[model samples]
Target: MSFSSILGYFLGGYFALVISLFMLSSVVPVAGFAARTLSAYISIVICATYGVLASIFLRIVGREQIAQWTTARAFKYVMAITIGITFEVDDPKRHLDTVRPAVFIGNHQSELDVLMLGCIFPKYCSVTAKKALKYVPFLGWFMALSGTIFIDRKNSKDARQAMAGAAKEIQTRKQSVYIFPEGTRSYAKDPGLLPFKKGAFHLAVQAGVPIVPVVAANYSHVLYIKDYIFRSGKIPVKVLDPIPTTGLKPEDVDELTRSTRELMLKEIVALTQKVQNRPIAIPATSGDGVVHASGADATLS
Candidate 1:
């Protein structure tokens, strides 16, 4: 069958499933959570599937560097419609465009964090992921194919090597990398932060690049897995000003990470006071088609 035919079938099947769950949710409230969760996960599968193909096509064409960017652009719309959430990016300073060869760090929440990535992911960027994720089906396949930097958290030597590779990418290729310094998902109901891992800071300082913090308001109000509370809502995200690491040393990594986390915590607390169902404010994108302030700039990268 042709590509359009395949797409039609997929869309039809997905909507049929989502609609069925919505109807069920009206009677059984937990079904709402199920609908949202399934829709989100399935949407991820869709993006992964597309990423796999996009990566293949780009690799064949020798332009695979933008595979994540291509997939991330498609990811925003696909996941947005399925999950029934809107991402409002606030980047008044256009940091998302001008900055390159930087390390982006963000607060890790639940799975919905991917949606945040979709909203603001820019061109020519790759993500850093845990090594384990390289084992998942389509998602992992796409990440590995699309040039994601995977780190083995359990092995310090391996993790350092991964960071070393990332630092080289930043310096040599001028590539930007996104990382979650929280190291794991918070899954918290309130806007707060866990202590940050210093790898991201180390990478930035080592590479002589700036550190950009992407903060998403606490979204547990939209997706709380423990309580099974998943509903359609808007998430507000802010891309703060970049913190320069041009003259930093290894010893500076600790203070840099600490001070950066403090800054992001303040922003998350402020932005987390989001008002749901408010007017949707579309973030401005530059002529390069890069959205300002996407954290995960997200592979939820």
Candidate 2:
């Protein structure tokens, strides 16, 4: 690593320690949360200012480096550092080659999935998110600048159009798209897996690409979606083999989604068993095609 790279890593590590210390303190949880949020807001401003300036600098100082694949790799690490510190992540490794430009499907158990994955996969990819993320001051602006695709989930027609737009962007532009098939996070320990949302599979079919199933193990063990029982433990990110949809039809979207969900569930169960060092029963999926606490099987008809 160059001097600049070393500096970036040190800064990134310090930032993570400071941020985690500020937020996880019991003396002032509210203050800590507010501080973290404020820091995120500030970081967005700093990153925007510096990132744009860096791009411009690259344009001026060394056009070759800016255009070089090496610089892009550096930027990915920088972004990954920012994400790791911000989310208090531990031992993040990309188990798959994200260079091929494919759709990523993962189990959603917390709000940190996007931030965590965005940091890990720093390629020119897009995420299918709700319209709300597009309105946030800093996050919204940054995501837009990063070419994220926003979908209006409230209106079915708008959602379809958004999905179509995303598909076109992926197929034509070769941009990877990340989507949480669960459509939401689960709070239960044995939440298993949520029903796969058809949108992700549809995108894969429309784009004629494979879907990379990513299993974020033990995310809930750290900081759950609905609680503050923060545990200092390693969250493993396992990027499984990509499920090909080369010869799939739009009508096969449901099957594709279900198959991916089942595969991810199996992976998560395996990981949790190893990490927690005990055998635990995973909840069965619901009738709506999502994993539920009641263990009801949800079939997509």
Candidate 3:
């Protein structure tokens, strides 16, 4: 509702138009799939270049100003992408001060979760992604530069190792890591977290970090992974209070995961109720942005 948000929305709309045009030109068969792929690659390179330049400018000019702008840009891009797909998304984060260097577990409902979450967090945060995304043109490069952690989902051992490495990064780098515990997007309401896989939680416990649970609704209805088109509707995202791990050990991973999963399910139920009854406001930001000097932070306490 502020002037800045409105301005950001407009700026993002322009960027979205450009990207969409490139997407179409590269896809339309006159050039062939290979050519389209190549075109997409070129377009991605340009976008990556822009991202790098912006990052540099922000770092050099004023770190705080850039952080603020990046925050707004994240919102703008998510809003633009939502608009591009004719859908809407809401973002909310709770216990943000205790959020840094913690594992972020979100309800997996659609493919758009990556973009939505990326926009919500600061740039240093990473998403533990599948290896397939590495093949994406601009996305892959951006991921590389942005320090995204990718795992080879096909190879169990490799995936486990990648998860371990990602956990290490979260601990050592003191960065936020996002993962979808369900392993895949769900099509049903209150799908109940698809059972928290041990990978994400194991990493959290290993890193001695808290788990910040997020509940997202109406994303699947807006855009399904099977297709890339956009749809418009209110997609509410809620970040719940984080589960602390002050005295936690790896042995408690299962209990932590289970409790967080149950709590997230409850949040989903509440979000569903809000959707059915009245408007819900997803907070633009939450948590205090703090990082401990020693990597072993029990900040959530």
Candidate 4:
């Protein structure tokens, strides 16, 4: 790693620890849920500020390396230090080396999903997120700098145009796009997924790229509001084999979406069961190297 990259990693962890301690001390007089909430927000703000600064610095010195340092390295360090968030990524060697661009669809559980995905996603990948996130201070500023595609969901016409532009970028630049097909976070008490929106599937078909499904183990057990103030644990992420969209038409979107959802849902259920210490069937591998469940354990930082 370069000197700047090393400095970024150190600063990320330092900022996280400093902010966490300050918040804990400041909230000592306060009690209960309010204190925990305040601490969480404080940690978020500090980490976000660090991210924005790193993004700006990288953009100035090496524009192409911003996401590599900020998201893949620095942000991973911050999350590990602040929230005890770690990842076990699946075997990415086969998929990450593909020449063709792909659409990465993942389950959305909380805002933290973005951080986790950023750490594991392949290089040259950009994110598709709600347009409103553009207003979220430092984080939003960094996202805009990173060329993230933002969709205005309130306006169908605008959203379609944005999606089309994203698809064009994927094809022309051979860059992958990561999107949350769920459109919003799931707040349910149990392990479940929301019905996916069709935009990501549509994009894959339009771009004639594969759809890579990413499943993040349910984090409700760690950060659910009703249960605990704030807990720390591992977040296992599984990246499944890519489903090709070759020779596929727009009409096939529903089937594609359904099949992909089923694949991800099964994985999520199995992951949840494993976490809860319940008996669950291990995923089997197919002849094509696509397994129902397959991945190697990896810690982000």
Candidate with top lDDT is: 1
lDDT tens digits, residue span 1-301, model 1: 9999998998899778878988999899898998887787777887877888999999889777788888887778997787789789999998887898788888899777777888877676789876788999867887878877665544444223446656776788777888887777989877777766667876787688999899998888788888889988788899999999987876665577667877787777777655443333333222322112213211122
What is the clash tally of candidate 2? 6
Model 4, span 54-97: residue lDDT tens: 66776777564335435555556666765566667775655754
Candidate 2 lDDT tens digits, 161-273: 44665677677766676777776777656638766657777667877888888776655555553554443345666777778899898667666767777778888888778
lDDT of candidate 3 over 188-296, digit per residue (tens): 4333445556567767776778777777755444554344433445566677767777777656665776667667776776676566564434322122212122121
Candidate 3 deviant stretches above 4 angstroms: 1-75, 81-94, 129-140, 150-164, 189-191, 219-230, 278-301
- The prediction achieving the highest TM-score against the true structure is 1
| RMSD of each predicted structure | 8.6, 8.6, 12.0, 9.9
| Higher-scoring candidate on TM-score, 2 or 3 | 2
Residue pairs with backbone overlap in model 1: 117-298, 121-297, 296-300, 298-301
Tell me each candidate's TM-score.
Answer: 0.81, 0.66, 0.59, 0.72
- Relative to the true structure, candidate 3 reaches a TM of 0.59
Judge candidate 2 at residue 3 and give its lDDT. Answer: 100
RMSD of 2: 8.6
How many backbone collisions does model 4 have?
1
Off by over 4 Å in 2: 1-95, 129-141, 150-162, 225-227, 288-301
